[model samples]
Target: MNIWTFDQEKDLNTTGAGLIAALLQSKPKAVLGLATGSSPVGIYNELIDMYRRGLVSFANASSFNLDEYVGLPVDHSESYRSFMNEKLFKHVDIKLENTHVPDGNAPDPDAECAHYEQLVNDHGPVDIQLLGIGHNGHIGFNEPGANLTGGTHVVDLKEETLKANARFFPSFDDVPKQAMTMGVASILKAKQILLVARGEDKAEIIRTALRGPITTECPASLLQCHPNVIVLLDRGAGRFM
Candidate 1:
C-alpha cells in the first residue's frame, strides 16, 4: 500500500479531490464506492467545490456506499443515506438512479444484502473505493474478528466502532448494534482503493494497519495485500507512524 501524508485535513481533501478528478477525466462513467463518516466529509466537500467549478462532473458516474445501519429508517439523521444526501449527492450532478445505499429499513435484510452485492457485481468491481478505518482498524463495517464475511452482509458493530460513531447520534444506546456493510473481500476487489484518515484519534489504528502486522484482528490491515491500495492520512492520523 502507498501512503500519502498531508499536513492538514484540507490538504488531504484536496489531494483526494484531485485524484477523483483524474479518474473522472479518464473514465467519466466510473463506478465509485463511497464511505460515510467524518473522515470523508472534507473530501466530499472538495468534490462539491470541483462540481461547482465545472472541473469535475459525476453525471455519468455511479456510486455505492460502503455501509449503513441495519435497523434505522432512511430518514434517520444518522443513517448513511441521509449522510450521503446532505454531504455529497445534494451538491453533485450524479444521477439519482445510479446512486445506491443499502436499505436499512428493509424487512428482509438478508435478501437486501444479496441484491446489493449483485447490483455492485453487475456494475463493478468498483473503479475506485473510498474507505475510512475504524479506530480498531475495521474497514466499512467489517470489525475485527477471526471470521470476516466475504460478501455483502449484516455485521454486529464492534464497541469501538459504536463509540467512534456516537458523534452522529445522541447517545451510545441510540447507535444501532448492527450494520449492512460490504465485506472485506468485496472492498479489496475494487480496482482501486483509497483509504482516508484524519485526526489523532485515528493514529493508532492507522499505524497498526499500515506498518504493523496484517491480520483479521485489525481488518483494514488486509488492505496491505491489495495491489492498488492508497492510504491518505493527515498529520494527526499519521502521528503514530
Candidate 2:
C-alpha cells in the first residue's frame, strides 16, 4: 500500500489523473474501474483538462463503473451512467460502446448481476480500479456486514448510505433503497487499486479503514490485502495520518 497526503486539492486531483494518464500511455487498451460521487469529481475534471490539452487520451481505453442505484433509469440525472457521461466519458475520447455500468433496471436483476460479473471477467483484470470510501467504510455499496458478497450483486442500502445519498434526491423517500455493486472479490481482482478520499468528514473512517485491522465490518479495510493499492488523501481526509 502506498498512501499519499496532499495539501492542495489541485495537487491531489492532478496526481490521481496523472496516474491514470500514465497507465493509458503505457497501455492504450487498459481497462479502468471507475467510481462516482464527490471524491472523484476533481480527478475527473483534471483528466478532462489533460484530454483537452492533448496530455492524455482515453481513445482505446475501456471502463467499468463500480456501482449503480437499483430502479433508477440509466438516463436519470442521478444515475451513475449519467454521472460518468457528464463527468468523464463524454469529455474524453473513450468509446461509449466500450464503457460498462450495471443495468440497474434489468427485469431480472439477479441475471443482470451474473451477466455483469461475467462481462467484467471477460474484459478485465482491470488495470486500475478507482474507489471512494463511504462514511461506513463501504466500497461500491458493499455495506458493513458479517459477510461480503464475492461478485456483482444487489444490495439493500444501509440507513447511513440512504441518508448520505438522500441529499441528491428531492426528498429522502426519493432515493433508491437498493443498488447493484461489484463485490469485494471482484474489486480485489483488479491489478491495481486507487482509492481517493477528501474532506474532514471522512478523516476518522479513512484512518480506521487504512490503519485498522482487515475485517469485513469495514469493507474498505480489505484493500489492505491488495499488493498494489495507492491511496490519495486531501489534507482534511488525512488529518489523523
Candidate 3:
C-alpha cells in the first residue's frame, strides 16, 4: 500500500489525475474501474482539464463503474450513469459504447448482476480501480456486515449509507434503499486500486480502514490484502496517519 497525503486540493487532484493519465499514456486500452461521489470530483475535473489540454486521452480506454442505486432511472440526476456523464465521460474522449454501469432498473436484477459481472470479466482485470470510502467504511455499496459477497450483487443500503446519500435527493425518502455493487472479490481482481478520501469527516474511518485489522466489518479494510493499492488523502482525511 502506498499512502500519499496532500495539503492542497489541487495537489491531490493533480496527483490522482496524473496517475490515471500516466496509465493511459502507457496503455490506451486500459480498463478503468470508476467511482462516483464527492471524493473523486476534483480528480475528474483535473482529468477533464488534462483532456482539454491534450495532456491525456481516454479514447481507447474502457470503463466499468463500481456501483449504481438499484432503482434509479439511468436518466435520473443522481444515477451513477448520469453522474459519470456529468463528471467525466462526456468531458473526455472515451467511447460511450465501451463504458459500463450496472443497469439499476433491470427487470430481473439478479440476471443483471450476473450479466454485469460477466461483462467485467470479459473486459478486465481492470488496470486500475478508483474507490471512495463510505462513512461506514463501505467500498462500492458492499456495506459493513458479517459476510461480504464475492461478485456483483444487490445490497440493502445501510442506515448510514442511506443518510449519507439522502442529502442528494430532495427528501430522505427519495433516496434509493438498495444498490448494485461489485463485490470484494471482484474489486480485488483489479491490477491496481486507487482509494481516495477527503474532509475531516472521513478521518476516523480512514484511519480505521487503513490501519486497523482486515475484517468484513469494515469492507474497505480488505484493501489491505491487495498488493498494489494507492491511497490519496487530503490533510483532513489523513490527520490520524
Q: What is the TM-score of each candidate against the true structure?
A: 0.97, 0.99, 0.99
Q: Write the per-residue lDDT of candidate 3 for residues 1-241, one digit (tens) a residue.
A: 9999999999999999999999999999999999999999999999999999999999999999999998898999999999999999999999999999999999999999999999999999999999999999999999999999999999999999999999999999999999999999999999999999999999999999999999999999999999999999999999999
Location of the lowest summed lDDT over 10 successive residues in candidate 3? 65-74
Q: Residue by residue across 1-241, what tens digits does model 1's lDDT show?
A: 7888988778899999889889998999999999998888999999999999989999999999999998898988889999999999989999888999999889998899999999999999899999998888889999898888989999998887888778778889999999999999889889999999988989988988988899999999899899998889999898877
Q: Count the backbone clashes (under 3 Å) in each candidate.
A: 0, 0, 0
Q: What is the TM-score (0 to 1) of candidate 1? A: 0.97
Cα lDDT of model 3 overall? Answer: 0.97
Determine which window of 10 residues in candidate 1 has minimal summed lDDT. 159-168
Of the pair 1 and 3, which is ahead by TM-score?
3
Off by over 4 Å in 2: none
Q: Which lDDT values do the candidates have, in the order given?
A: 0.91, 0.96, 0.97
Candidate 1 Cα errors over 4 Å, as ranges: none
Candidate 2 to truth, TM: 0.99
Q: What is the C-alpha RMSD of each candidate to the true structure, in Å?
A: 1.0, 0.6, 0.5
Best by lDDT: 3
Candidate 2 residue-wise lDDT, 1-241, digit = tens? 9999999999999999999999999999999999999999999999999999999889999999999999999999999999999999998999999999999999999999999999999999999999999999999999999999999999999999999999999999999999999999999999999999999999999999999999999999999999999999999999998
